[model samples]
Target: MSGRLSGKRIIITGAIGNIGKEAVRSFVAEGARVVIGDIDEHAGRAVVAEFGGATHFVKVDVSSEASVASLLAQGVEWLNGLDVLAQNAGLQRSGPITGFSQTDWDALFAVNARAHFFGAKHAVAHLKRSGTGSIINMSSLAGKRGGPGLVAYSASKGAVVAFTTALAMELAPDNIRVNAICPGWVDTAFNQPAIDFMGGANVQQQKIAALVPLGRQARAAEIAPLFVYLASDESAYVTAQSFGIDGGVYNG
Candidate 1:
């Protein structure tokens, strides 16, 4: 396919999620062997069916240390090696500082923040072996700014950004680059419920074109190529950076 990610073995967490599922398709089309890890058995199996044997599915909670460990072990086993790791699995629950439960706060940290670390930890050895590897973490603009209803999710994402930068330095000597993407509101199923909760009946939908100064919400396909770029040799010198694929929302 003359794709950037050709011949790479990729692992994507939350592979059943809207953006994640699209990523599995794109990465594979671009010549990567992908392993899907998600807690949703049915959804994971459905995705596996769509691609037949091209993908392997792992049932991972990603928040627990043991689950994270197991997922990585299995992911590497399935793919034979890890050339790229996309830590896109996460959960978002709406909450203000006060109404947020200990449960929700902890959950957010475990999935949205901790999973990235575990994924990176597991891939480090293989990445070093290849003499170069890339770690692409999925973040949100909410991490860079304040969002009243998503305190926990925002904080966890901010942690991801910091982690990505620090990791870039850790792996740079190995010729590996680490980066995160700060996507603006994207039209994905997981995020749609939040829009509905925010009193946006076609609200987030209509605002898509106006959300950013460039005038549009990012679609999954639009955001994916960047992931491929960062994970491939195309971004060899780019590391410790968080890119905003916001259509210009971050400009504000």
Candidate 2:
């Protein structure tokens, strides 16, 4: 909280959710002024009110290029510039591969994969000019390992990882760092829908104990510090990296 990200300007998409809210708070606590880009106007405004001076809210439908562009323009205006873009807006559609509808697949990619592209496309110019920009894409452990009925969701998250790596190389010359965080079974309301899709609360608990060596899902606060590390100059040399913050699940 003592100026790790002092004087930085950051934009965080999907800032109303369990994980995203924490990212917004963490960024603010570390001395960064943040623009929260989210579709939930109510929640966004609430966040702005709670954080006061250093935070602003802008409505963003990440699946739309126009919306993403508008968010960037408005955010830059509020912050006076940009330094970090955290692309955390995403959608999860779960179903067996054989039963996955084309509509669901398209929706998943539009929000999860295409949104990252839209964010980076609009933000790169400002970031490149800022000189030490960081782009943090929110992926999931499901991206690295397939889940039984999460084909579309997994595929979309996997695209985030691949996109992050490719964009890192492309942005290296501009000194903008790109990285992806693949979180595993975070204990947040954002994951309740996925848990229900998998089975239910009882089944999810069993899966956590059996599958995760840490024997529990992570809290939103637990996963947030990583965002601070990646966004701060502390990770100046880290780029093109896919970090797995999964309670030992990726290995165990």
Candidate 3:
């Protein structure tokens, strides 16, 4: 509403999901033109329809470098430029380290960690041209403080934080800012993996109530504002930081 991101062009990977959808809405509301990239064409198009003319959709498989490259290319072409890239595509698998399969670990890293690298690698040139670019990678509080049955997921997200920090310093000279958002206990189906691992929805809620200082989980909308701020020029001086949007779940 404040048009904080007026005239900005943004690309959000995994834009069909809970947090991604909210980020798209928030970005569009703030006057940014956005490209919604996801693996699901049906959902991606629906998101574009919901946002009307301010958005476009691109089908992308973030695990593949070629797909990631194509998404950025198509997105930059649609917006005629690029200002922000939000790497929100990720997957979670929760289980004890003793029985965790190599397949699961590799899959988690492919999306949760490697995708961010792919996105950043392809987005740099266009972002440099924009002169005021920002990259927002979605990490998790588990990435900061590992949890039970979350070994693989935590490792992947932690990789995102490390990559974001290093990339920020590498690109700072180009005026490109890179940062990571580490959220905790967001109440969305996206947490179904961890929820099931904990037992069920009831158990997940109980744990959230006990663990988080705020005694609850965050809504996707509650997490979207940070995306808006990081994407806007308001965060021009902010880079190489991992911001925790958790309900006081992480003290570090």
Candidate 4:
């Protein structure tokens, strides 16, 4: 840990999720105080306990505006103020368009796309107060290039990309940097649902090997550093950008 984020205060939603858990570890190791916000109370508490200090867990259902607001309010109370917000809570429902139910579509967007907007809308004030703040939205490679069986999930993530771009311009004058990360195939349990939809774990990996130029999936640890960099002063000049960390899957 280089203390790159020393004295910073952060709130990471979906803290119990695969990618969110890695972000928590990376941020804390770099000396940031983080509030782990997630619906999974047990996992969130476990991370806080492991981190020992400078880490707090608050249960949050990002899909609700009230829940998002509460997370920010409680997080700010614990950390004194907010410096960064990682809108990482997301869900995916797979199926072809013809069979995609409205329930699935709404649920997917509620957490994936809608949550990003609410998370930022609630945190912007606290962020602006920091003088310079950062918001990292977790998108996906599926969003950039549509996935065959991920119609609902792909559309929801694509919404996040557009939301990030629009919100960046709106928040630029306040020194709040907004960026999105499009990850290809990161090894995490979160991929289990998609894998099951694609046939099975073996089939999924085979497909990834053929699709991803890297020929292998990335570990969660490999994706955590980008969150640190984007949230730290190291990327001060970087804003309004959608970074692809997808094993060379998306060139644009």
What TM-score does candidate 4 reach? 0.98
**Per-residue error at 175 for model 4, in Å?**
0.7
Residue 26, candidate 3: C-alpha displacement in angstroms = 0.5
Each prediction's RMSD to truth? 1.7, 1.0, 0.7, 0.9
What are the per-residue Cα lDDT tens digits for candidate 3 across 1-252? 799999999999988889999999999999999999999999899999999999999999999999999999999999999999999998989999999999999999999999998999999999989887999999999889998999999999999999999999999999999999999988888899899989999998888888999999999999999999999988999999999989998886
In TM-score terms, candidate 2 sits at: 0.98
Tell me the TM-score of each prediction against the true structure.
0.93, 0.98, 0.99, 0.98
Mind giving the per-residue lDDT tens digits that candidate 1 earns over 21-80?
Answer: 878888877788888888998999999999777799989888777887788789888888
Model 3 clash count equals: 0
Q: Which runs in model 1 stand beyond 4 Å of their true positions?
A: 205-211
> For residues 1-252, what per-residue lDDT tens digits would candidate 4 score against the true structure?
689999999999988867888889999999999999999899889989988788998998988999999999999999999999998888867888898899999999999999998999999999988899999999998888887789889999999999999999999999999999888888888887788889998898899889889899999889899999999999999998889888998886
* Candidate that scores best on TM-score: 3
The positional error of residue 115 in candidate 1, measured at the CA in angstroms, is 1.1
Query: In model 3, what is the error at residue 125, expressed in angstroms?
Result: 0.5
- In model 3, the clashing pairs are none
Model number with the top lDDT: 3
lDDT of 2 by residue, 51-144 (tens): 8889999999999999999999999999999999999887877778898899999999999999999999999999977877999999999889
Give each model's clash number: 0, 0, 0, 0
As for candidate 1, its clashing pairs are none
- Cα lDDT, all candidates: 0.83, 0.92, 0.94, 0.91
